[model samples]
Target: MKITDDMIDYISELARLRLKDEEKESARNEMEKIINYMDTLNQLDTTGIEAMSHAFPMKNVFRKDEVRPSADRDDILLNAPDKKNGAFKVPKTFE
Candidate 1:
């Protein structure tokens, strides 16, 4: 999975990147290191380990939903910069 200079060039072209020779070399080395690390991880043994979505045990901790009294309409509308007939108003932009 080592990234070659040609591969780096192709990726740069696809991404529309303009890279100097030094940058291309740097990218190639970094990509190679990432592939090597993945190769190292693949060598680990986990024969009976169960796959899990979460690292720790978890349960829903949400509070029960309940309807509550709301503020008066006029009080809430007071914060609006522009209002019309108890509704927020905005400038019309198009026909």
Candidate 2:
């Protein structure tokens, strides 16, 4: 697709960018080159290639989740500077 001055102006407005006359021309030329390169890529053949989410193979590396005994609640509450109703009390953050 060809990048026109009007298209550049529209994009600049959407991006909330204020470009000088020279910068607008430069952006238009850069956008045209990018689109031309994309068009060239569209000519490639990939009939039997499998689509991948990433360029490299990936695998989950998580440890097994196992149930374990937890520390006593009273033992934990003993260390708190402030406690209320068996829970740690914190200052109100919002109204």
Q: Which is the leading candidate under lDDT?
A: 2
lDDT of 2 by residue, 1-95 (tens): 98999999898899999899999989999999988888986788989989999888898789879988899999999989999999999999899
- Model 1 worst lDDT window (10 residues): 35-44
Candidate 1 lDDT for residue 67: 85
Best candidate (score: TM-score)? 2
Error of 2 at 27 (Å): 1.1
- Model 2 stretches with alpha carbons more than 4 Å out: 45-95
RMSD of each candidate relative to the true structure: 9.5, 11.0
TM-score of each predicted structure versus truth:
0.40, 0.45
Estimate the lDDT of model 2.
0.92
